[model samples]
Target: MARPGPRPARDHGRRSQPRPAPRPRGRRRRAPHVRERAVPALAHEGEVPSLARRRLSRLSRGVPARLRGPRLLRRALSRDDRRPCARPEAQARLRGRGEGSRLRGAEADEVGLVLGSTQDRHRGGLVSGIRLERTGALVTARFDKARGNAIDEPFTQELLQVAKELGADPGVRGVLLASAHPKLFSPGLDLVTLIEYDRAAMERFMRLFAQAVWALYALPKPVVAAINGHAVAGGCILALTADYRILRRGGVQVGLNEVKVGVPLPWSVALLLRASVPPTALTSVALLGRNFADDEAIAVGLADQLADADGFEDFGRARLEEFADKDTDSIAITKGYLRDAVLREMRARESEEMDAWLERWFSDGTRERIRQIVAGMGKGR
Candidate 1:
């Protein structure tokens, strides 16, 4: 009876449950590479990357392949490219490659932007790198100088001349100040250029700069600054002179950063700021001299509108036209009244202000800082 074979399994009185099979621990799956996750179609098919794909590759270059998941891949393909890369080194590397702030040629017109092609249409090279284009009642003054449209003698003179020309022309109902290059407006004074100037030369240019800014500030027409790029120091002052400012939405900064560089705002410049920014933000904006992105700039009243960089120029033109279509007579008169006090203060204290600015400009500490800044920027004369 008991053949002593295997015991008949001890089933005491309960039914036994079957054990599940163990999961095979194959080599831990490596996260998919960015190319695979971002563009599976192209990756599997083994085709060359297009501009968009190149941008994606660059966006994920330094990131670990494991971290380049589907979420990050989506961001790489979408509007977030307007933001900076996750890695600082990657950003600097991109800049060194002359790509200019993650601007890719995925779209049609952006091809031209990435190619660094000049706008040949309606371009009048009136002042070397500066261009003046007149279309109907709109006059566009574009600064396109070397070194981010540096504020040198020719630049100051061109601005002053353009302001005068627009003020006198009865048919000109609006003016739009712009930059030929989309990503760089102006970096204020040409420190390297100015560092070589003798005292007389420096004073003369500074005086001319004041006159230019005053002329721009006092212009009666609907003046709109279409800033598609970085605008700091003198550039910010130039923007403030406008009745309204439209700045490119992302990856650009605008500020009156004179204090950071050991310079004070000239009287005319200070007046422009006081009128443009709100009283609540005045002290912080003027005294701190901090750079602000598009949203922050609009919030502080430094920038009036935010525009996408893709068609920023056209958008600015349409916006300027909107303002220009208003009642020219009443708008002119009202603007004059609003600006009268600023003009009075400017005229009364121009001499004293110039003297103070010159004194500070030539001070030992300021000069040393200026030299250091120039050296750092590798813009030495």
Candidate 2:
């Protein structure tokens, strides 16, 4: 027949397999569901991130009461506490705690040395060559420096800073200035140091020196100088700045020896001498540049009183107490009125006077005299 009709393509002895069904439009096939294993809980209870734990521990130790416990924890954990370590109070507290702990590393060693030595020395603050101690309304600043508490750039600056601080504090009623050295209040200006300065440097030094002197002279609170030892040259100038000068009874000498040293007295220093010294003795005291014994110092108005070493502190304290009952405002006002003319003159002539001082200080004759004096000191030592 017609080839048996294209006869159903011949059966090749194999059964036909059915095709897979098509996915529905707009619908994806779902993946098989997997059973996930649970993670185990931490071994300790109330566990937190390491950083958070550290923060909480610090807060618990030194933070204010209101900022401790859960309140602090909540704040620390919040996003708002991004810079928790940057808080000033927190930083200060942390520093205090660190100071209490053992010191390690270079920075810790440095800070520890300063804090420990200063605390031991004054139980207060140490600024350069000066050690300051505060007791009630009174502050005592003791000068202790190499070479007899010499008045150098650093010493002058520190003394000025302390004077300014005391003057600004309304609560500070009095200041006591004393020397740590037993035989010397101050050997005056450190000529060894001064001899090394150039003309410009000398000018700067004189200006700074004058400023320090004026700061102490004009301080509102009563200032008493306990001159327990020899105070010569610049030291004498310093003693005169105080409202009351109590010299310890001894062979210790006190006087302005600038003339002997081949240097002229600065105008400010001259004015101070005028105000403190007896008019009759001013010529001898200032012109001669002689060092006076405690008895003579008192007699000539170079020192207000004389006290034995054992009674030096008592004398100074007594002097300070003399003004204790006086009205602070009235006392300050009276002092201002008494010193206004001199202070005004000082302000007007500061630069010119300082220039003259520098000229004298850096002169060839003065330099040679200073060298000889230093050499003599070395030889004596």
Candidate 3:
């Protein structure tokens, strides 16, 4: 019927498809040139796209529209308008423009100014037979003698000098005495040296030894002893000079053992023991020459407190700080009043006492006893 619906159309060789609609022309797609240039510039500036976005967010909060772009940021960083940050290397790199652009130089100058004003504040250094360190108002002197920190002629002289220097230093508010040895604060006098000494040598040694202890005892500032190890004989006498003595607990022994070694106690040594040890225990502590452990020492008033070995110095420091508020001049005056009699007695009797000690030391019985003691020490070692 439609029989020839118009014989309408003749067959076409291919079917046609509809075309896509044209994009709106309002903004005209961004040119490829713009995208390519922008991406590479950001890449060259060592900023990742995400980081750049974050920076842009931060900049947008306060930057004017005219200064909001990456071009302005780059220009500002390149010019020396602001500090180049705290990084030294970065500042160094940026300082190539001229010496005036060196930020670190200014910082160094400020630092030098501060250091110059204080000199070597809080500095630490060494002296023979001891190490001295300064921290704030506290100064510490550590005994480091070669022979168990034994009181030898040289050791005594050095210690005496150090004590005098620290006593005279206005900057040092307090002094802490300690031993560098782990097991022996000091084993007393160097017997080997003593055995070799003649009357003159022994006299000189004893005089200086007395002076050394007196220096510490009379020191204007407070002195604290950190007895981290054995303090026997003369070592105990040394500790007794301190305002406070803190003993390390566990296996450490302290006392005047002169009688046990067949050596009679010096007059000064006897006085020190009488002053520090309880009067009731003085006979057993000094006469019997018995050694006491930390607890016993504390019980007998030979030590102020018992501290763990690791914390001895800290304990001593705390003890010193207890007097931090006391006027140093007042303390010196009071201590002088309390100790003047003892010091005077020692000074008055030193010559005669030392002569008698030298005579006893060279006696056949005492010399024989000392030889045995040295032999025993050698065997123990």
lDDT per model vs. reference: 0.72, 0.70, 0.69
Best by lDDT: 1
TM per candidate: 0.66, 0.67, 0.66
- How many clashes in each candidate? 0, 0, 1
* Tens digit of per-residue lDDT, candidate 1, span 119-220: 112332223345555555777777877887888876787678668867887978998889977677888898988988888999899889989988998898
TM-score winner among the candidates? 2
Ordered from best to worst TM-score, the candidate numbers read: 2, 3, 1
Query: Which portions of model 2 miss their true places by more than 4 Å?
Result: 1-127
TM-score of 1: 0.66
Put down candidate 2 lDDT per residue, 1-381, tens digits, no spaces.
345544333347754565689867653333111101110121012233233444455555644443344445543332312211212223443565653333224433222211100111233222246655444466667786778798888678767877887799896788888887888899888887777888888788888888898899999988899999889889999999888888888687998888998878899998889988879988778888888996788888888888888867767877887876578898889999988888888878888767666677767897888899989988988
lDDT of 1 at 169: 76
lDDT score for residue 87 of model 3 = 30
lDDT of 2: 0.70
